[model samples]
Structures are given as structure tokens and as C-alpha cells.
Target: MLNLVELPDPEPGDGQVLVEIDRVGVNYADTHQAENSYLSPSSLPLVPGGEVVGRTPDGRRVVALLNGGGGYAERAVADLPVAVDVPDGVDDTTALSFIVQGSTAWLLLRRSTHLEAGESVVVHAAAGGVGSIAVQLAKAWGAGRVIATASSAEKRALALELGADVAIDSRAEDMKGALIEANGGKRVDIVLDMTGGTVTDQSVASLAPFGRLGFYGMASRELPQAIGPGSLLAHSTTVAGMWLPHVFSLPGNVFSQAMGELFELAAAGTVRAVDGGVYGLSEARAAHEALRSRGTTGKLTLDPSR
Candidate 1:
């Protein structure tokens, strides 16, 4: 439903500055935005982009995250807080990844569940944008064991290389068994789930006592079974979810701190982006199709200059 029609360039509103975008992050949330199935509501004729790295009028390079979806265009009106100068040594796409995917990965452990050292962690979609980084971060932050699952062996191997203690096929027939087996016959202590449907059901069933699971993406377009009090009471499990826009309220310092931490990680070689590929502005539709195909690995981007 995307049309490459020319529209007048946007002007900065009050407290907003104009940015000539260098790179636009193509997030799974943007795909949901286009389909009108996002967690929140949207009307027709929307521009689909949540994060971008660009230059302001004075030529300061900055990273911006917009919930209003104007980033697919040549320019967007970014305000002070959601817009911050890109750190030294980080590329446009890598900075954009931190705004959404990287921050989400951090909050999944730091906020959603206080990851205790030595706790077993499982990361589904282990080669995708967030999962790939989560695998590395879990290890860097002191996880005892990290289990990574992906649909391909190359991805599983990549997870293993990124410090995962174990890797398994995401398409295992007995999902629960595969996870438990990968953990050396023990239930997982924490889980980060993006793939839904049976993958979620099996993961929930594989939770250890006092286990915690955080849901961020449902790329499979499948919802997990509704949970009841009985399900949690039996094992004392906890479940939580997060959306990035909610964290920007204290924008002056909130997300900025997270970006700083990720930048440090990047500088130390503790983490890096998995470049999925960059498409031209006119090829936004194609990019969404690639995401819907669910075959993309790492982070995909769009070049607004085209």
C-alpha cells in the first residue's frame, strides 16, 4: 500500500528541528504500523519509519526516533529529546539500531527483568536485530548460560560465536523439549520472546521456578495462548512487555543514557550491528515484504537520499 509519490518536504514545528536523514531503520514495528495492526491505532496515508540517523540544519549528526512515522521521507521534524548527537565511532545504522532494537534488548533485561548473574537466559529469533544483540549482551552482563534459537544453522552458529552457550533450531517439533535439552535438561530462568504462536506456548511451559519472560515482537503473526493465574501460580513465573515510545517521557536523560551505554559497548567491541541490508526510499514496500517474509537477519535500513 506504499506509493512513492512526491509530497512537500516537512517543516519543523515548535521545538522541532529539520533533519536530512542519512539512514532510516526498518523495524518490525514499522511493518506492523504499515499493516494498521500495531499495538496502538493509526489512520491511512502514514509514513512508515520509527528511527533514523541524520544531520540537522547546523550539520550535527543525530539519531531520532519518531512515533509519528515521517522518517521515510527525505526529512523529518525531530524534537530535542528524541534527537541526540550520534556518538563517535558509531555509524548511522548502528546508532539507529540502538534507539529501538538495542534499547529494547537492554530494557528486556535491565528493566523488564533484573537479570541476576548466573541465571540461564534464552533468546528466540537469535539472529534478528534485537535477538542478536540480546545474545551478546546477556553474556556480557553475566548470564550463566545463553540459549539461542534460529531457523537456520548459520544463524545458530552466529549466536554461538556471539557467546551463547547453546544454540538450537527454532523449528524443533518438540519446542519445549528442545529448549530444555539445550539447557542441559533444565528449565530456563529467563526468556526474551519475539516469535509468537507455538514458540511462545512451548517457552512458557519451559519456564523454571520464578522464571521471567518478556515479549517484544510477534513476527510469526501468531499470538500465544491466553495465560491464567493458574499457569503462573504453579511455578511463580512473571511476564512483562514494553514499547519504546513510553520510555521517552523523561527523554532528556532516559533513553539518552541507554544510547550512551550501547555506544560504550560498541566502542569496546562488546557488541555490533548485523547489517541486514539497505533499500532505497522508493523501495520501502520491498523492504516490508522482506520483513514479512521473515527471512531477514540483522538490522535492515533505508537510504532516504534515494
Candidate 2:
């Protein structure tokens, strides 16, 4: 269903700015859109992308969020508010990292958890697009012990290099046990579970009394079992889910402030975007395959000028 076609350049309508894209972020959400599995399904004839870093007509470099898909093209139209100037130190790809994955990490750590110093946290898929950023942000925000879970040794190592105090193999036969052991032989204070299904239960069980687990994605493509009151009666734990699309819908300063903080963090070198690779725009198929393989780390970008 992925194809490359040539069309006339698109013009920006009211409240929209046409950007000459320099880098386009390839997100797992794009996969959901491609398969019509997204919470907000993509309509037919969609272009299939969400984030991009580009320059406007005035030549101001900016990172833009495009909900309706169109970033894969050489030129993209983004809302004026969604397109903001990139800081001096951040590159195009790193700037693209902010709008979705970076902001999501910010929201999860700053708004969702209110994580405090000396609190232990577990980040599943810790070397992933969003997970990678989450790991760094957790450490920057003063998480006492950061536990990361990944499928491979390299990924676990990557997690460690990204400020994780402990890195466990999520595919290990004794994953839960290993995670608990890494957390001082007890459940952690917080769990960032992007992989649902069995991990959901494991994450809940891996929480300490009054622990909190934030559920965001289901990259495993499996449905998690329902969490009943009985599941948390003993520990008094809490599990909450977040959909970024909905978060962006709220009208207020909360969204803008989070994004501003993300930019500041990147500028301060507290967190940096990890590049999996940059493929030509025509190589979108290969890009999607790389993402689906679950073998890539950090962020993958598409360059239309290649």
C-alpha cells in the first residue's frame, strides 16, 4: 500500500504554512495509520507522516506537527501554531524528534507521574523512539533508579548509556524477576509500559505500594487483559493510559509549555535525539519495514532531497 507519486506542489491554506521539509520522522504511529489501526484512522489517499523539521517561506527553521499526513513530500503544510522555531543547537532530525516522541516523553514524566527524586522507574522498550527519550528525561528529572527493558543486549546497553540505572532483557524468560531484582529486589515506583498484553500484568505486579504505571502504546500488537479493582487492591497501584492525539486537543498553555520545555531540554543537552537512520523519501517502504522489524533504535528519519 506504500507508493511514491509525483503531484503538484501543495499550497498552504488559511492558518497553515507550507514548509520545505528537511527531515521527516518515521513513527510507529505511522504504522497504525498505514494499517488503518490508528485511533483516528487515516482517510483514503493520505500521505502518511506526522512530524517534520523544515523551513518556512521566511527561511525560519522549525519543527512541525501534521495530523492529517503530508510530511513525506518535499513540501508539507502545517498549522502555524504547530510549527515552531527550532533552537540553535538542535538539528533538523533532532528538532523533528520533539513534536511527538519528545513531547510525549515530557508529558509522561512531567505531567503524568510527578516523579520525584529517589523514585525508581521502569521504561519498557527503553531504547525505542519514545522510550529512548523517556529514559533520558527520567534521569534528567531525577529518577533515583531507572530500569530499562529491551529485546536485545545491544538495546539494553543502549538504554544504560542513555541514563538507565539498570537494563533488562524484556524477552528473558524471567523478565519480571530480573526487573524486580534490578529494582532492589522490589517493585518499582513507576512503570512506563508501551508494550501492553503480558507486560501490562507484569508491570502492575512489578509496582510497589502506591506505584503508578503509565500505559501509552501497544507496539506488541496484543490487547492487554482488563485491569479490575481486584488487580490493584493489594498494592493500591494505579494504571493510566494516554493518547497523545487527545492530549494535543486540549485548549490551553499546558500543551505549549510542555513543548517549550522539550525544546529547552534539547538545547541544554539534557536529552538528544538518537538517529536509527535517514532514508530517502522514496525509501519509505524500507523505512516502515525497519520500524516493523522492531530491530531499530532511536528515531528514523526520511529525507526527500536524497
Model 2: per-residue lDDT, tens digit, 141-205? 88999999998999999999999998988876665677789988987899898787888877888
Q: RMSD of each candidate?
A: 1.4, 1.4
Give one digit per residue, the lDDT tens place, for model 1 in 1-306: 888878899888888889888999998988898988899877877887888898899989999877588889888888877888887789977887788999999989888878999999999988888998999899999999999998888888888988899999999989889988989999999999988888988888899999998988788889888565888887898988777777766436667778889999999999998888999999999999998887888899999878
Q: Which candidate number has the best lDDT? A: 1
Q: Estimate each model's TM-score.
A: 0.97, 0.96
Best by TM-score: 1
The TM-score measured for candidate 2 stands at 0.96
Candidate 2 segments whose C-alpha is farther than 4 A from its true place: none
What lDDT does model 2 reach?
0.86
Q: Tell me which residue pairs clash in candidate 1.
A: none
Cα-lDDT of candidate 1: 0.87
